[model samples]
Target: MNINSWNFKKDILILQKELFDSIAPQTAENRTVANSLLLFLKYSAKCLFLKWLCQTVENLK
Candidate 1:
């Protein structure tokens, strides 16, 4: 909820972009594979976060 939290997330995104740019090949080939991998990783992280959030809320109840 804090402004700093938003800024920190933004910074993390920027760093992620930089990492992707560095790892992905410049050629057209394999680009989709790289994107798919990143997408899978993102979704996996979201699922883990949601699980954690649910556990936290239940604990607080």
Candidate 2:
């Protein structure tokens, strides 16, 4: 089959739609990763503070 026989505009539109569809999931995934990273940072800071507090208490004993 000749490439010219295909509908070029329609093919381009389809490809564009597919590209957007594929990208949509990545956008959602990025949001999830960002949220997870924030949670991790918060938890890490809390843990560090607790550890430091415990060490200080032990030092006083």
Candidate 3:
């Protein structure tokens, strides 16, 4: 995939980190939240992409 595209894994990771943020009440808490955020982003990203594709196809002639 093109580097400029949102579908790139690197871009996803970067965005995930940015979205997750590092500020937390403790180190372990930050780590746990980070892991959960990563999983959430991965699943949500795939699901959203699939939904978008399905909708686009449904709109086709």
Which one wins on lDDT?
Answer: 2
List model 3 lDDT by residue over 4-46, tens digit each: 6746787789877876666434677879999999999999999
Model 1, runs deviating above 4 Å: 1-29
| lDDT for 33 (candidate 1) | 76
Per-model C-alpha RMSD: 20.9, 3.9, 21.1
Counted clashes in each candidate structure = 0, 0, 0
* Alpha-carbon TM-score of each model against the true structure: 0.52, 0.70, 0.51
* Off by more than 4 A, model 2: 1-11
Error of 2 at 48 (Å): 0.6
Query: What is the Å distance of residue 25 in model 1 from its true position?
Result: 12
Candidate 3 — number of clashing residue pairs? 0
lDDT to native, each model: 0.91, 0.95, 0.84
Q: Which model is ahead, 2 or 3, in terms of TM-score? A: 2
TM-score of model 1 relative to the true fold? 0.52
Worst lDDT run of 10 residues, candidate 3, spans: 18-27
Per-residue lDDT of model 1, residues 1-61, tens digit only: 8999999999999999998887766544578778999999999999999999999999999
